[model samples]
Target: MKEITPNNTNTTNNSKPMQQRKRKADTLGYDLNLATSSGGETAEKGGDGPQRRLWVKDRSKDWWDKYNSADCPDDEFRKAFQMGKQTFDTICDELSASVAKENTMLRDAVPVKQRVAVCIYRLATGESLRLVSKKFGLGISTCHKLVLEVCSAIKDVLMPKYLQWPNHESMSVISDEFETLSGIPNVVGSMHTTHIPIIAPKVNVAAYFNKRLTDKKQKTCYSVTIQGVVNANGVFTDVCIGWPGSMPDDQVLEKSALSQRADGGLLKGVWIVGGCGYPLTDWVLVPYSQPHLTWTQHAFNEKIDEILKVSKDAFSRLKGRWSCLQKRTEMKLQDLPVVLGACCVLHNICELRDEPVEPDLVNEVVDDDDDEMVVPEVALRSEFASKARDTMAHNLLHHNHAGTSIL
Candidate 1:
C-alpha cells in the first residue's frame, strides 16, 4: 500500500431525476445511499406521504451553533467531535483555502467550520452517511461529497505540516528521548503494522482477503494494512497505508515507499525498532527470534517490547479517538486511504495538543505482526545490524541499565 494521495471525486448525485450515473454500479458492495438525497431544499422521497425539509433547520443548528463557537464550553462537544474548539479552528484555518467556497445565487456553500465538523464527526462516530446527513442537516450525497473533499484537503493541506519525518535537529531529540525511555541508543522511532477491516470488493477479492485473520476468527474477513513509525512521544514520523491485507508485515515493508527512503540512505546510521516479523536490516532492528535466548538477548527483547508498546498504544489511542478506523466503512476501496490519512493527521493533532481520549472508548488493539518468524537470508540479515544489536544488548546488562528484578 502507498501513503496518502489526492484522488478524483465525482459527486454528481443531485436532486434531479434518476440518471444513469446515480444508479449503483455492479461492483458496489454496500448500500451507502441507493436512497440518497437529490439535494433540493424541498425534496421528499419514499413510503407514506411527503417528508419535506429532510433533516434540516432543527438538529443541524442546535448541534452546530453551540459546538462550532470559539469557546466549546462542553466536554460533550469534544465527545461529539474528537477535538477542542481551538483545535477545530486550527484545522479549519489550515484547510480553509482548499475547502472554502463562495456563496452562489441559488444557495450558500458550506462554511469551512461546518464542512470540517461534518467530516470529523462522521469519522469520530463511524456513523452511516445517512446518519451523518441527519446530524449535520445535509443531503446524504452532499455529506459523502464533503467527506471526500475534506479528506482530500487534509491530505493536501495539513498532512505535510502534521505528519512528516523529523528534521536533523528533531531526529536528535527523538533519538535521545527513545534512548532514555528504553535504554537503547541511536533509536529514533518504533514501527508497527496493523490492518483496517474493509468491505470486500467484487474485483480482486483474494488480494484483499485476510487469511490469517479470517482463520483466527473462523469467518471470512478482509482488510488493508497500515504501517506506521512513531517517535518516543507517540507521534507518527512516517507511514505506509492501503496495502493488501493478505501481505505480511515484511512484504508490506518491502513494497512501501519507506523502504525506498531507507534504500536511498535516508536511514543510514540510525535504527528503527520493529517486531520479529521484520528482517534485521542495517537500519531496522527487530527482536531475536531464537527460542533459547541468552540473558543479554532476553534483556534486549524486553527493552524492544517497551519501544513496541509506544507504537501499540499510539494505534489504540488512534482507533479509540476516531472510531471509523475500528470498523469496516462504506467508503469506496479506492478512497479509503485518503480518509485513513485524515484520521492519522487528526490523531497527530490530538496527541500534539494533549487531547485525552475517553477511557471507555479505548479498544484493545490486536496487531498480528508476530505471526511469522523470520529465518533471515544473508541479504535480509545484515552483519552490521547483528553486531549493533549485540553491542546494545551487552551494554544494557553490563552498564546496569537492564531491568534489575526478574523475580
Candidate 2:
C-alpha cells in the first residue's frame, strides 16, 4: 500500500525548453530510501488489466475507407430514414440562407449541409443531443443550438405552406369530405373536439376536473381541448390548439377563429355538418350518433379513426401519462394536434394519388327487441336524425318545404 507522489523535476536538462520536458516512469513501494537509490523506477509487469504503454498506438484507416465507399453506407436506406427528404433538405437550405443574410451579426463555422443533416438526424432518430454532437463532430452546445434553431425555422417556413388549405380547391376537397354524413348529406364536414393530456398547472390541478366525481380513474390526467374539423374524406380542414381541457367544447370553439364562420353568416345557407355538440342553425348536424343517420356517418367515423390511429403512431413520442413531464421538454402537447393536421394534409395527398384498396364489408342484423329498449329522442335522432327530421317535418307542416334539400 504505497501512496502516489509527484515526480522530482530535473534542471540538468535546462538547455531544453520546459514544454519539451519528458515524463519519467512511475515507481511503486513505500521505502523512500530504495526509491532514491534505485532511480525511482520499477520493472514492468504483465497483468490482466490494460497495459500502460509509453508510445504504442493504433492509427487504423480501414474504417474510414469503408465509410467512404459508395456501396458501404447504403445511401438509399439512409434516405428512407430521413423523412420528407427533399422537403427537409429545402428547409436546411433556407436556414443556411437566413443565417448567411445575418452574417453581419454572426457567421457559422459549420457547413450548411452538416448542420441540416445533424438537426434532421437527431429529430428523425430521437437521439440525445450529446450523442448527436459526437456523431456529427459538433460541440454539444452547437448541436443543441442548431437543432433548436433549425426546428423553429422549419416550423415557420413549412407550416403555412404545407399544413393548410391554400386555395378554394383544397377547401373544396375538405368540404367534400364533410358532406359525406347521412343526416347532413349536404353538410360540408363535421367538427370534433379532442384533448392533448397535460399535467395540470400547479395551481389548477384540483379544480380542473369535473365536479361530478363519478370516476377518478377515468379522469386522471388534465388536458387541453383541441378543436378540429375533418372533411368527408377524413382530412383535417381546420385545427385550433391551446385551450385548456377544463373548458367546455363550445367555449373553446367560441374562442376559435373558425367560430367566425358560423357567426358571420358565412355558413347561413352553406351546408356544414357537425355532431350533436353543434347547434342546429343554418349549418347541418351529423347526429354524432343516430340510427337514421346516413351510412356516411359510419364512413366519416371510420376516416377519423384512421387519422387518429396514424397520428398516435406518428407522434407516439409525446404520448405521456402525465402532462407536466411532457411540457418540460421543447415539444408541447398542443403541438400534437398541429402535427396531426400536417399528417392529415399528407394523408389527403397520398390518397388522391394512390390507387384505392379493395373493401371488406361486415354485416350484422339487430334484433327488433333492441329497438324497444331505446328511447325515441335517441331513436328518431338515430333514424331521421334530429336536424334532418325536425327540419323536414317543420318545412312540410309549416313552410311548404321550399328549401328542404337546398344543401
Candidate 3:
C-alpha cells in the first residue's frame, strides 16, 4: 500500500489564496458584488466504513448579500458587528492568513471576511447558533467551529499588536494622566472585575457558582470572572480572565499574572487604583475603607474614585459592545476564555480607533456590587507603602495635588 505523503496527496486537495478563489456568489461579508455566479461539484466517496449521501446543502445567504452589497451601511454594520467597516477590514486582513483554510473536496474553504463576520455578529447579537447558521448560510456546527477558530486566530495574531503592557515611555504618560485625573502618583492603570454568565458545568459545578451575585440579583447564577486593568484612555493593558466567579477580588488579584509581575518588583513605586474591593497596598491604591471617614479620607475617596471610574467604564463598554458577554452565552464552558480574550483585545482596538458604541447599546451585563473591602491576600505593603496612603490622604486634603480644595 502506498503511504500518505505530501507529494502523494491529490492535486485538488489544496488550499488557495482568497484572491485566486474568489467566485461570483462567494461574497460572504466582503463588500464585493462583482457579479452573481454559482457552481456545484461532487466529492469522492469516503473510506468504506459506511456509505452515505453527499454532505452539501442548499442554504441561501440572502441577508449577507443584500446588506453587504454596498460598503454596508456604516451605522447598520456597526450595530450588527460592533465595529465599523474599517475595523472589520483590519481584522479580516490580519487574520486571513491564519483563518483561511484549504479547499476541501466537499466544499470551498470559508472566506476570511465571512468567518470574522460570523464570529463578530454572534458576539455582538448573542443570538443562538441556529439563527447564526441561518444568517450566514452555514451549518450550526460550522458557525460554532468558526467562532472558536477565528477567536484563536485573534488571540494568536492580533493580541500582541493590540493588547500589551505599556513601554516605559507609555507608562510614564499613563502615570501623568492618572496624576492629573486624581492626586495619585505613579498610577499606571485602574482595575476592575466583571462577570460573564455561563451554563453550569456538570462537574465541580459548585466552584463556578456566583453566590454573591445570585443572592443579590435573586437569580441562580454561574459565571467566570474577567479582571481588567485599563489605562486612562480606557484601553485594557492587562486582563486575567476565566477565573471561577466565586473568588474574591483579592484572591483573583493574588492569582493573576499581574500579581506575579508585581512580585518581581515590576509594580514597585507605582499604583493601580481600584474600588473598595481591593485592599490598599504599595501598588494598589484603593479608597479608604473605614467605617467612619476623616475629612482627609473623604477627600481621598472622592478623588481616587475618579481613577476607579476609568476601569469600571471600560468594562461596561466591554460588555456593552460584545453583547455575548452581557448575558448567558451559547459557547461551551471550556471555549469561553478564548472568546473573552478575543473580546478584550477587540475592545482595545475599537477604543484606540475611537469607535463609538451605538446609541442603543447598553450594558446588559450586571455590574458587581461594591467591593467588600477585601484585604490584601498577603503582606504586600512595606513601610513606605503603609505610609504612602497617609501621605496621599494628607496631600489630597491640603496640598495642590488636588484640583480644588473642599474646605
Error of 3 at 108 (Å): 1.0
lDDT of 1: 0.80
The digit string of per-residue lDDT tens for model 3 on 1-407 reads 12233233344434333334444224342223222225222223356433222222456888876556676688888878888888999989999899998776444677888899999988888898878888987767778889999999999999999999888899999999998888678999999988888888777889889987788789989999999999999999999999988887888888999999988998887888887677667688777775787778778888887898888888888888988887787677888999999999999999999999864565454676453545555534556765888898897767856535554
Per-prediction CA RMSD (Å): 9.5, 14.4, 9.6
Supply candidate 2's per-residue lDDT for 346.
36
CA lDDT, every model vs. true structure: 0.80, 0.43, 0.79
The segments of candidate 3 whose C-alpha lies over 4 angstroms from its true place after superposition are 1-56, 363-365, 370-383, 400-407
TM-score list, all predictions: 0.84, 0.49, 0.84
What is the TM-score of candidate 2?
0.49
Q: Pairs clashing in candidate 1?
A: 1-243, 15-38
lDDT of model number 3: 0.79
Global lDDT of model 2: 0.43
Q: TM-score for candidate 3, please give it.
A: 0.84
lDDT by residue for model 1 over 1-407, one digit each (tens)?
11111231334444323233234421232222322234322334464534443222222455566676656675877889878777888888889999999976545677988999999999999998877776676666778999999999999988999999998899899999999998999998999988899988878989999987787778898999999999999999888999988887888889888899899999888999988778999999998887798888888888898999899889888888888987888789999999999899999999999988887787554554445643435324688889889999999999988765541
TM-score of 1: 0.84
